[model samples]
Target: MNTNKKAMMSAPNTDQNILKEENNNRIIHKKTDTLVYALGGLGEIGKNMYCFEHENEILIVDAGVHFPEENLLGVDYVIPDFGYLVKNNHKRKILVITHGHEDHIGGIPFLLKSVDIEAIYAPRFAVALINKKLEERRMLRGVKIIEINEGSRIKMEHFTVGFFNTVHSIPDSLGLLITTPNGRVVETGDFKFDLTPVGTNADYQIMAYIGQIGVTLLMSDSTNSGVEDFSISEKKVANAILEITKKATGRLIVATFASNVHRVQQILESAVASGRKVIVFGRSMENVVQIGRKLGNIKIGEEHFITADQLSHTPANKVCIVCTGSQGEPLAALSRIASGTHRFIKLIPGDTVVFSSSPIPGNGQSVNQVVNKLFKAGANVLTKSILNNLHTTGHASQEEQKLMLQLIKPKYFMPVHGEYKMLVQHRDTAIETGVAPENIFTCANGDVLLMRDEKVYQSSMRIPADDIYVDGNDISGVSTAVLKDRKILSDNGLVSVIISIDSRESKILCKPVIVSRGFVFIKDSQSLLKEAELIVYNALKERMKTRTTFSEIKNTIRSTLEPFLYNKTHRNPIVIPVILNSKAAMLQMQQQRALKNSNHKAASE
Candidate 1:
């Protein structure tokens, strides 16, 4: 018997497995032995994707991407492996997005292409952003995107999901409350407790009500678990920035993440209040502003925005530019200006460049390099460092995390969205807040937690949580060899040798041409290149008249040239030997072979 057939026969029909009747009407309920797993966003800060399953149905939350780590040489971003989602795509119905940040929605484009999704549910702002992404990929028509808001509830066949507002760096963020037959699980998307945020704050009353009803399980953000105090308010950051721009004598340039719409709003507010014209740069920042304004997430007057032509006409004192590169990304707008490469914006004396964001881990050196450039260009650089309260984090600190844990007071707690150490610290904080040691489970990506009849425990079955890289535009073509070659080029540079060879006789028909890029100077290293050409010529002579394959000839050249180049330069360059069978050379060899065959035929006759 086939294993699939046997498994199908044993599989339970969850649609009719569990149900209840209230007031003579049947409610869609199912007996859910739940399996909760994280394909990404565990044991790290970004790439947050989670799966909730009951029997044959699964609901996905927060498809995101991770920023490249230190060792991932040329990778732009890392997305979830998606193997689990692909395997269980039939079981998946809806994918719920928490917000519009790239980490939360970056992988949506890939997920839409990889799996069979029924629809995607997100807030209006997130919908607008995801629509922009899909439009870029020309995938808008094939996707079903549903715009949801607070107080909205989606009842699936097996579970019911409710969304409530949560304050974060961006607007339209929501926390999910999922109800199943066994228990209720609340997932608070990345958040902080800001009594007075720029937009909407967390619904304390609703959270308290959920706590009163007794939540069975709770998953909370652990990004700021290691911090001891509460995060500074976004309102405070706005106030400080407003004052900073008000005192600018010349041009004021504020750098921040484009996705932080609230921060951009504040920057605009400051620019307006300071009576300065706002000129936005960077393609990413321009797109965010365009979408935010259209979606009503950001409101700014048209007169406040000026173009490059208008910028030159305005007084320097009345100019304010909001750009990218707060994290010191090389190609971002602010970095270009700092390096004197920007076309429109040029840094001059008395210009104040404010970094309105914090540097992500592993990006401090890059940020420092940008700052050094800004100083060298005679601009005054301002950052959270050496400044009092310029930027604030969006994640909850230890005190705020405790408050959330105390307010929810769930029977079981699992920390999401942080490194391993941060997750452990969150678990300890939960224990201090009266959660049971066994109930507070700390798991990494792909670790499965099973819940049945109000009991949750670690299960042996796990999902695939390996991550894939998105290098440039193509995702699948970036294999290990591609990355290895990239690292070799970046580290040691490359050298190429082009040789015209006689294919029939396996002999060199001309002098070898040696070209080097980022390896050695041709004019200064002429002697070295001459030596390399001679070495390659000798190797080809060794294989002359033999049935030498291209691989053997190339390897022989590599074996002879690698040591010579290394001994001369004390550096290893990637040697590439190109054996071009020239048209003339191959034609001559063919003619010789034909003549030999004709002479043999004549002798036989």
Candidate 2:
């Protein structure tokens, strides 16, 4: 039956215009049902993965990765696990990428290493961007590249796919229209209805035609669904930035996302218009600008785009430096400049620093730290607080979402790209707009929604979705436990206890070493550290007679030491208990271990 179904699905469809009508008959007319699965972009935004199955062929959309939160220290990037795709790769046909945003394309390099995709369809700019990335990995050799323009149609047996222009920070962003045997689903990739966008805001006429053709489901971006009003256009921000650069006393340094070409263009144009020499800072920022300029998405005079050294020679007041590290990433140019760590440039009192990008969620503290450093260095800082109107979001707001919903008028609505609250709010918004509650589907990561004959049924399928942490060239998956640990360390301080325990019996061999971070300092509370060590030592002794496993000894030390130390020090630190197992002949070695633990704990505290 499976073989027969595969043969039938492998048969190509000749009718492209009447594809939807033919799809309805072929999809619903099947003996078996079809399932829709989410490989990414379910609970949290980014790493968007979705699959639609018809008979035997499956089409996957948007394999991407999310950026690591603030506490993921030393992590380079994150990607989704492709276990589901690998297990079912025989049925998977093509990966339809929506845009070139990090969240949408960041995982491609990592994903391709695992699952061999048949083909990839993306817009021109995204294709160029992705090809550069794949080439860097040496994975672009045999890959089939299909450049899809707005209104272009792709046929794969029972499914007919179409692309519509989407307005985002990147050029050539597109929305996907997957017309299956049963119905049509319009996946609105990250976009905003910017009437004055640098490029096109989603092709409405094509959507109107799709609406006439009839859409059963509309899986839309819900990142800003709960946000009120329309997204402010990039053109508006350019004028705002231009206004700020005109009155700058010292060098005007603007920090933003490297991938935000729209924002970069605005900053560059603002500088050029203000008669300021523009110097691009940061290696990553320079790379992006070079690519965008080559593709004609951005333009700057050869005289205008200069190096930091060139800017130093030019009058500081006549230079506008566009750089990276808007999130206050430690090694970013802005962060280094603020810290007085950069060799070429240091922010002076009269200098103007503009944070053109807003702080992403979880990066508030880091952003504030950078702002504080700039302020402390006597630089005149202009952040979101003062330069509130200096930047605008690329995501579509409530009004735009409502307009989109009103346009497509799908039978079923699935809200993608947000947390549970955002999804529920979006669902309710659709409900208020007359979309039936039954028609709105709010799903999480690893959920499978089956649509049969225009009716949707859902089941749970655990798709391996996780973060890939990279430092330098080394890449590894970060466990959930590591993220949790980071959250705890950032929120509360870390308290480490190094102890020398008996080889056979888990007894306190010496004064327990205690170290604490994000907690009370040893200089201020010397007595507190002494007390914490005693607490840890007593707990280790208490567990020595009862515990056998390493984990038990560690847990007992934590539970017993945490409360006692917290009560005494008035601060809670992450308690790490280390047990040193050794031989009786190694008394000096044991003492050294005990002494090392003691010193480590003292330093940590």
Candidate 3:
């Protein structure tokens, strides 16, 4: 949606208006059944937000954000439109978090600013991360975050929510089982079936018991559904990391996701096993490590750690650095080190850099650039490839997806978190596991599903699910038009033409001056620029003859110069016409002259 539409929908109204709208929604939604829809994370990966509504109570699952793509210039991230939640603010609203991953909790701060949430229920790790975020934004006041574990159960007015342990890359990960008046709904938050996990084992007993009880609908993660086999266990990756660390003859530097606490733990264990002192780099890495230690998730001792000042005194072969930037983000710690710009660390000969995480889907080129830089700097680089088994995904593959489906045995299956093709593949897997094709609903972001009397139905009505671009701190400032203009400016550049005119007599005061930036070389293209100036001068002269306004004069110049420049250079740069009022300039000059004369006379007297 455009910026105007976003502002109109999201702008805060008067108290009376808000109360009136809330009252109207309360009356309108009294007969509404169990409605399910997603604000984000359906057609794409990352930002995941799902809504479950029954009567006046709403249970929100995972307020997250999606990182911007390459084309989204100047945008930091994208969040789901909160129009629906804002409109139903009078209802009993509760947010439930699944994990501590950025995609699952990055949008919590923004969501809290938009909606007045009653309370947030999350696991201990996720709660710590959320509090950190809220504190950073100075929004920790008046917000309640209740910590819940596998055995915890929350009873609201319309739903009963419970958690089950799931095996992911991070510790304290969970899947949710929400019970409504209509039936039971299970949300498998980013999971895999790893028999030997690093943190916790998947609770198959609870999953099977829930299946035995019967679920009306199931929303499962579909990130890796296209892969044929099951995902590799984190334990296998830990062993691989240990092997690599033991074989290295020089200093070791490993890069991975900061939120992957299990992987970080393995890295530290490997460091201790190899008798190497550890140094953690990157702010996010430090925060996660500190939190993990405080929570007893990481068991590394303080004696194994060293500061940057001690790196030079310590032997090169005995130092291990764990950092962020496995995805090759330019500002990340590993990227700075690869570019030879890091303040404390520099790449030296015999230094082995291991990317302990796979490159995210759109970051292959960036990772390749970093690898090339490291190779040129006389450092050895190893990544996740067929020859090396340094990384394992946290998502479930096709077989594991089938296992989840068989265990849940949902009456209606809806795939939640992946791209379109991945969702379709998950639907096929569901079909293979005895779920009817008609019972599986592969929906887009805004499509709604209603469960009435234990039967799910697709609704014709929809809610606002458009992406709200976040540019810096302002939410509605960046629009599609703004992005289009930015693209044009980046591609074609800019040109400005300045002219002075006496508005009273409609007379031209001087020749038009032309300036170009990224459009053309002014010195080399003097002849072409001269022609363009002549065109602007003539257009203004002709337009002024008809008592034209400033806008008309500018339009005349643009219309006359654009085609001429295009025909000459075959480029369509943004052409701007600047007008100077000579009448005002003359009046200011007269005033200055009068003041000078009076001052001179007073000095002579």
Candidate 4:
């Protein structure tokens, strides 16, 4: 039961030859089993990627990125490690995307950076957003995104995937019905039972047809599984937002997810109905809106929408601003405005700031910080928690999950797209729907589920997986030591000891000079600096005879200063010893002292 055994132990293949071997042997010997690998999005809330492998052919679904936690300092985003896929990419036949949400499609650019994906299959609306993102990353070359509809059937080497309509906050969402050798797997891509949805109601007719076809496994969303009731409809939220916009006398500002096309549509309609000219901010929001309009996914009159440049000239009472960063993302439009850093937009006394989206689980602190900043900026802020009708969840609740379970009638169920607790809750719900307890799997990232002969079994084998952190254009593992050092420097400040060593002998040239930054100011704390210098000088004196290594000197300096600095100032500043030369400087003072003694002795004789 060595679950930690890595997958694809063989060497990696070149991009030119990876798919050659798989594509050449298209003759399918349908095995009686299907392997499901959860690359990400098991215990975590974001980064949603999965793999379905059968007959040595892999079909990847939803390559996505995860948002960094508070502790992941300087990280722009996090993604799946892709180690297994990199080693075994020859098995990949095609990559399919579920939707356009960041959690579902944000990692495409990064994946394309390394892996050579031939084609990407997505719906029309998702394709529009994906094209814009790909163009931004300059990754549109050599890539093809096939636009799919509800009835489109994609026949791969190991699976035949069929699409069905689902109700979501974003328009043109789809549910996947993948036919494999083991049976059929129904993948729910973020849905809610919204009969009166803002865009269109869930396609119950298509879903019932799939149910009649009989499903083998149900991989469902568990985001709101902890809530035991149904979530409010998006249409209700639109009406509520409309009412708020009508009552506001000054500029009404709304912040939400940029990919929420239906929400954006509702806001636009509300703006038009309330006789307010809409101004869209944030690059992502602008890009999505532009692409959506071009693709005919978002419809609005030309006069109803204006750019940010026109905000200054437009009357404040007649303006409605829709922007990104309801989650308090650092560089998003709402954050810039809340911090009073936006070049054009500023909150007036009568301005109303409405957050139409609730804060994500890990984003409470940042959202609160933004709200507090908005309050300090003299704007009236309204949140869903306080107003109750401002925001509605796009995920299926416990009741909806239960309903899906009953409708699909899956013999085996595995909860997807949520935390561990949510997954467990969903598993229990599946049990309540009469699915056998042993047939339900509440798995974590990298846990594999194998369905064989219409029976499902959870495997102990886990492939090596690591969090791939993206900081700008560079992709690396979550640099723990670097983040820890950064935290220390930020919290306690920094202290550096500059030691000039001679190239001749192994000794210090002069008194070790100490420079402090962010710690106690040099001008104010000379005594502390002097004492620190003495400590280093004494340590150097002890190592004067031996050829001390640079790392040795740095370690000695840091280990010596850390506890003392903490004890003295109640702060543990980052300590660095700058060894000027790679080798210890030759001791010039010893030669000078020896010459002085020889001169004295000669004079005395």
The best candidate in terms of lDDT: 3
lDDT at 101 for candidate 3?
91
lDDT of 3: 0.90
Task: Sort the candidates on TM-score, descending order.
Answer: 3, 4, 1, 2
CA shift of 196, model 2, Å:
1.6
Local error of candidate 1 at residue 357 (angstroms): 1.6
TM-score for all predictions? 0.87, 0.77, 0.91, 0.88
Give the alpha carbon lDDT tens digit for every residue of 1-605 in model 2. Answer: 66555655665753322122233333222344456767678778777888887776778888777776656865667666677677776775788888888788877777776677888899887888888888888889988888888868889987898888878888888888887877788998888898888766668887787778888889988888778988777887877788899989788999998888888988888889888888888987887888888888888868787775676688888888888889988889999988999878877778899888888888889889999999998888887654367778888888888888888888889998887777887898888778999778898877766666766655433456554565544445666677677677777779888877774555666888777777777788788788767766676666677746778878878888889876776666678877776677268667888999999999999
lDDT of each: 0.87, 0.78, 0.90, 0.83
Model 2, runs deviating above 4 Å: 1-31, 71-78, 376-378, 384-388, 460-476, 480-605
Cα lDDT tens digits, model 3, 1-605, are 96645654685784322322332232122274788999999989988999999988999999999999989988998999888898999999999999989889998888888798999999999998999989988999999999999999999999999999999988889999999888899999999999988888999999999999999999999999889998888888999999989888999999999988999999999999999999999999999999999999999989999999999889988999999989989999999999999999999999999999887889999999999999999998998888867989999999999999999999999998999999999999999999999888999988988777787777666888999889987766489988987787888888998999887677788889999999888889999999889888887887778676778888888899899989998889898889898868679768899999999999999
Candidate 1, residue 115: lDDT = 82
Task: Give per-residue lDDT, candidate 3, residue 40.
Answer: 93
Lowest-scoring 10 consecutive residues by lDDT in candidate 3?
A: 19-28
Clashing pairs in 4: 502-585, 502-586, 504-586, 505-586, 505-587
Model 1, CA-based lDDT = 0.87
Model 4 C-alpha RMSD to native = 9.5
lDDT per residue (tens digit) for residues 1-605 in model 1: 76655554565755322232222333332355787889888999899998888877788899998888767898988988877777776685689989989999999888887788899999988998899899998999978899899879898988899988899988899999999767899999988998779999799888888899999999999999989988888989999999989898999999999989899989998999999999999888999899888877778889888999898899999999999999988899988998899999888899999999989888999999999999999998889954567888888999999999888889999999999999999999999999999888899999988777887767656667887888886656367787888888888899998988877666788988999998987889999999899988887788775787889888988998899999998989899999899687668878999999999999999
Ranking, lDDT, top scorer first = 3, 1, 4, 2
Error of 1 at 184 (Å): 2.1
